[model samples]
Target: MLILAALLASAAPVPVASHERLSVIANGEKVGSVDAVRDHDHVAIHYDVKNNGRGPTMDETIELGADGLPQRWTLDGKATFGGDVHERLVRDGGTARWTDAMGARTAPARGTALYIGQSASPWALGLYARALLKAPGATLPALPGGRLRLDPLGPATIGGVDYRAFAISGIDLSPDLILLDKDDALFAVLDTGGATVREGHEGEVPALAALATRLTAQRYAALQQRFAHRIDAPVRIRNVRVFDPVTGTRGDPVSVVFADGRITGIQPPDAVASPGEASIDGAGGTLMPGLHDMHAHVSLESALLYLAAGVTSVRDMGNDNAFLPDLVRRIAAGEVAGPRITANGFLEGRSPYSARLGIVADSEAAALDAVRWYAARGYGQVKIYNSMNPAWVPAITREAHRLGMTVTGHIPAFTNADAMIAAGYDEVTHVNQLMLGWVLDPKEDTRTPLRLTAMKRTATLDLATPRVQRTIDRMAAAHIAHDPTAVTLELLMGGRDGAANPAVADYIGHLPIGLQRRRRQAIAPIAGPADAAAYDGAMAKVKQVLKLLHDRGIRLLPGTDDQTGLSVHRELQIYAEAGIPVPEVLRLATLAPEQYMGHDQQLGSIARGKLADFILLPGDPTRDLRELHRIAMVVKDGTLYFPSDIYPAFGVTPFAAAPKLTLPKAMPKAAGAGPAHDAMDEF
Candidate 1:
């Protein structure tokens, strides 16, 4: 049993009732602060984060009971993408209950059950660890669902103060690194840039951030091992309606045979299974190419989730420089079960609003150097970011071209899409980046939420206007590609708390509780009927933009700027709503991107000799776009993964029973096979 050290050394023993502040730093930058007061047994904390990632401005408060139990907790703030997060949890006697966007839920107050809502801070958990020091086991109960475990990694020091390090898991999408003082009070919250340390010690950011990365990576490594499924024998999928993206048609029932990580045969439904092979019954479902999420910032934690959702590949937009390459190798080596990633070096300019991912260059020469750095590492593309100087575009684009890397990115804050296209942008990143050009003033910065808020201007812009037509004509003539990421627009437009998201409407209840609730919050400011109409109309105008581009010869790449899971389906569905047709929507998510990447021959379509990468949908997506959500099994490079097997790790229920497998009895070896399936139903 152990407790944190004494109060923060800098704070010393408080002589009287006082209010103080703690600095919150992320990646070496001061992004937020926390205010707190302590009076005997009662301690109150107020936490706020301003610009760590996407300006999740939060105001959270917690009041603790004398018994070291949480008495009352409340959080009112905005989350990533601007979703309002307002929640409260109260404890009394032997019960604890919470009220959030999903309404009310209850749990026992004792034992492992604690009502730590999604809005609860990691600091709260650190305090809980101190109280449970001599209580019992390492595992503790969590409200809503799941359990949290604290593994003390022993003594460590931060900013000359001795503390104990602990990794908190099962609370977030990933584990977080934290530390407690000698008396078990929350001492630090850590990330890659630095530690959110007690006030005077904010200079210790770099050391803590490096440590956070190592600890987080170690936890994810164990997860990867528990999820990856490997196959030894040839895999045969029988009785499937094969989807051929090239022809935009779902053919009659067929039996597909794959082995040695390649598709070997496509036979009639009546074909007999070969000896020494494993077979799965597709039950006359549509077998289509595994989807591609063209815009992603993937992580080790999200790797298996992407594959589980039938997204077998992605075009990584940007990430931690040292991490992305190693992760790609881990996935490719079958050390982890994640989607194949085509890396894109993310470049941002050194500005106050600059994102802290990838390389941030301050000058044209530095930007060119960053481009070469990515190209030398075989990165597929270089994505420029919002804070970038528009003047550096030509030099950066020239260097990337010389190094054979394609150019794509935000249309820079002060510039328009036309200038970027002429400056050699092979593609644009998001629809808002392009549409804002039509509506925003030259001086309005797209680096802030204004890029999203200004979309309302589209409500009055005529899509048929010559100014708009000229832009469309140039895009068509240049064969410029647009990711659109229409789902991002939808999230900004339609996410009203306590409402169903049409994008994932069918899957709301089936997803993890926290995620299910988050889907209901609005991400942008919609103050009145007028603002709401503008939001709705802006969404409509973008679809018109999508429709016109498709009608013309402009390339449209379907991408999920958010989580690739389920959202990619929403992206394609939005495309279908714009009258692109379901067949083309499927193609956009599959063969189209494969062709753009110049790997169609080896990757996309259901044909002999290509890599065995596809998904089995219980229903036909060509007729009903929503049917894509009914994913049963996913195959990546001939390795089979049942969504039923992978989902539970992330607290999601399996969508369907995986195909029953019959492996050769003698000596079949898979590099990384998951546990045998209990949910499989044999044909």
Candidate 2:
């Protein structure tokens, strides 16, 4: 009986070998593929592996062939197997043995004899026969080429073949085929690891098991279309009141279109829209190119606030490089909303403060290299701060200009504005730069002598003098733009009283608490009596300097060196206070800086092809400058944002009107009500 059983097992009709499909997946997503074969007790799976965004995969496969036999095997997709597999297997036991293609077997002498076959083995034959008798007909869902479908979770029978169903959830491989016998035991599982298994099919295990005999496949081309929109298309605005700051013209209602990120047309309101065009109603609001804060720190939140204020562009005079690139990228990608930014990186000088801001280049070579470093990084310009030696100016300027960057800075001590200008500084900041030419002693020590000398020296270099006129002429001729942050100086020099200026109150409540604290600290020490006269003298000098610059026909751009957010508007107000007409003051904030930066073509005005950066106010600012404080809406790059959304970023509260205070005018007739001197002293 033993001999007969052995012969029958050896001669049993073996099943044919056929290719089995396999899938590989990662993180529950299909990513690779393979072909496999299965035997009764074991299966060998051959698979073509490919990596999808995940790491490499190791998988195995098994399947039944057309000859009704099963084959199975393991596959290490990484192909890292080495050494003697047969030896290792032989050392284990008779139950586990490995053989090479040359028929060399590695196994330890053991109790059971090993049987291996390419077709269905004796164990497989028994299982197959049982499956055939139990199952007759079954089918599986069709799978696309290069894809695999996971068997659903549940009991199933295919062609009389019974399968014990259990889902392999979160399998990071695509499945190509599945196999089971009458015992419902899984014999083979083939997968590519790169196929996706959809949900809601757990109840279809029986159906999938029935079709396991046939291979199903699918192709994955990564679903590339996800929330992507082109921002390059032109946007048009119609029936808008256009403000052309360049020509000082407020044109009638017009239609403007901006495409390819530039203004392409400015036609009458009746113009027709071209193909692929989008239009927005202007609602009779004034349309002007975006405004700019000539000086601003480039904080992410602050940048957004600037945009929310209708500032389409800004010149970041100071910021760390570590954050600039990301900010630039975010702005360009239309991610977080903000205006186009032009960064200067940081100005190099010799003071402690300068070092904190940027490199402190004390020598000519260091200065030259500093300029080159910034220019190389694509900074729009180089700023020279207060402690630079006057001797380093020429080399720094030449190097910067050579690298296609502009040089602008504060006048060094002992150097007048004109001297710095003559030495190649393209621009000078603050009217203080020109103080040397007007001060009697050109020193900070005693205001009495300087004030007396300034008053007496009017004949020598009075702002109206020919020499002063020549200096101004030279600046204009050189196209040097001046950014007099007069408001900052006024606040700094006006002995703390300027902090309470009504204009500042409008935005002071919005300042970040930290900044507000710091600002108070900065001005607190200067508020006392000993320094009072000095502060007053400084304020007087700032005013005189601003007036002188304007009278000389030198271009003036408004900037606020004050607390970043609260000061921009304050600067505009100061410009108005500095004798610049209201309209002109608005122009300085809106267009002058753009022209100074050579960005006028795309940025300075609101017309066709320009960015949609403008503010909407209840009343025209030109008619009543104070109306600027009432920002109704701000449009930046075609997106509208409210000031309320921005104020908190700066730690400021929106402007709230205070109740009006009234006093009795007839009180002066009552002498006993208060002594005039006492009242005057109290005031």
Candidate 3:
């Protein structure tokens, strides 16, 4: 991959002031700022950022060569959970190099290489795109060696501001969007939830974000136009190791065949295919059921991301009642790229501290009405939120169960998991939520950030004590499942600054450099020895609580409340750390969720007549859970997508090559590019 942008002398790239700044807002709160300055043949950028309510607090800087590419980049502060960042990239013409957690590395540079670094700032993409994206595939081949392909989607408008846009590919499961103004300056950095570039125009986010969503859909549609293979004949995966999530066993090399979204045949290795059958050479790789992320907040963007990561299915824990149904419908109709969704209704109560998400109810009858509302809308589960009234929970759960929707969510403020279970909660949301009762008082309002900040005190609790064990036993007896989003807990309360966190260390280098720097930012406050000690204690508490829950026969559901594509793999690793066996963990990620959602017979295991929702991996995930990251191909609802073909759009180099497939004669060609897709009609 490109080490960093090469610094070269050139004329002014854009009209500039000596210094310019933009306010950084997160969740509607102004938390920090980004400062940019330009001089003759030189530019510098600085970001003082903090993601609101449990995110990185970081300080970052980037210096551009006269050519407007990175010359030097540096970041320092608390990121991810908390880690000191000391990264620098220096390019002296022919060779560019840098030093990071992976150690020093050097690479040849073109001197005129027109590319951005892993990413110095969200604004940098638009800055570079302005100079590079004059036409399709214009700047890609010249980019060091990352093989990045920037396909300019053409001019588009956000809040009616006419801006040029492009889809950035090469690093993740999905491509991110970059926008430039009419003057060719970055209008904004548009990602899934919001943007950081258009700092002063928060009001435009909803409109820009909506536009971003539509743009991504168009790109994925084009991808489908290019890659999706639907032959009239049967489809077969040959010479592969079939993994049974139910048995945790890798079957002998066999050929699995399916068509019309159902597996129709399983034959011995080397079996001759029926006439006109299409085949994919699996080359002895493992074919396992697609993974399930049970704790997801569904979005149009995350849907594509999850599917690309081999998560063929996700259980959306909570989301916008207005947005999800349409997104889900489009995905089901094969109009969008995403996993099968089992949605959960978000139930919240109006309060001063209540999170502004999902449905809000003020009375018992309103809560019941909310339950009916979700049920009528086809939600299979109802997720109660932190600010919900404990007194109203029993009635809410009763109504939800009566409406055939399972109850799961945060134990309402001031109530324990045991109390929620007694109130008929089928499942508890996060590991911290399950254990918080052991460390908090009745008056502690969990609706605010305190719900997360207080987890450190759990370290002081003895797992064997009645206070903690009673809940475990009650949950086991009641068959109440716990969604232990372990990755999130560690991120919130674990990891020391400057130390390599095992949860992210192995994969950090593979992520986009900007995300790597972002991951290094801190979340929890660690002001001193006492504070640090509490953080340390929280990690132990997580292990103990999870172990006790597992050892005592309490059900533990695997999911990543964070982005699950790669994080889900880390979730399994964390489960293994808690002494859960690898095979069990794999089952927990696959068959377990399918069974819970009542789709086991139609999905999950790679059995006959099952839905063709599975992935081809380079290695066996049953043994090393991290192997899940090396996705080769994903078959969702019988439509095949190659990671090799998908990852680059998001800036990720493919970890493995796609299995060989014989293309059908009917395969479609790339549609026209250029002016046909220009966002500005008048232009």
Give the number of the best model, judged by lDDT. Answer: 1
After the best TM-score superposition of candidate 3, give how far the Cα of residue 495 lies from its true spot, in angstroms: 4.0
Q: Per-residue alpha-carbon lDDT of model 3 for 502-585, expressed as tens digits?
A: 567667766654455435544566666798788778877798778778888877888888763777888888888888888888
Q: Is candidate 2 or candidate 3 better by lDDT?
A: 3
Candidate 1 matches the true fold with a TM-score of 0.89
* Candidates 1 and 3 compared by lDDT, better number: 1
Question: Any runs in candidate 1 off by more than 4 Å, and if so which?
Answer: 1-25, 52-54, 76-113, 117-122, 128-172, 175-177, 190-219, 674-683
Candidate 3 wrongly placed segments (more than 4 Å) = 1-151, 158-161, 166-179, 184-187, 191-204, 269-272, 282-285, 350-356, 360-369, 445-449, 493-500, 519-537, 618-620, 662-683
lDDT of 3 at 584: 87
TM-score per model over all chains: 0.89, 0.54, 0.80
Please report, in order, the local distance difference test score of every candidate based on alpha carbons: 0.77, 0.50, 0.72
Model 3 scores worst on lDDT over the 10 consecutive residues at 674-683
User: All predictions: root-mean-square deviation over Cα?
Assistant: 4.7, 28.8, 6.6
Estimate, for each residue in 1-683, the C-alpha lDDT of model 1 and write its tens digit. Answer: 01211211122233335455678785467877777776654556666766623666556666655445566778887765565677888877567888886677777665235555566554566655654453346665667776666778677776677888887656554556687887667777876545677787777767676667666666656666665556666888888999989888999999999998899999988887777777788888999999999988887677877888899989989888877887888787776668999988999998878887789899998999899899888987999999899999998998899888889998888999989999999999899898888888899888888888889899789988887888888898888899898987888776666677655677777776556666766667767678778888888888888998899978898887776377888898888889897888888899999999998988879899999999999888889988887799889998777888777767676777777666655544455564553333132
Error (Å) of candidate 1 at residue 489 is 2.3
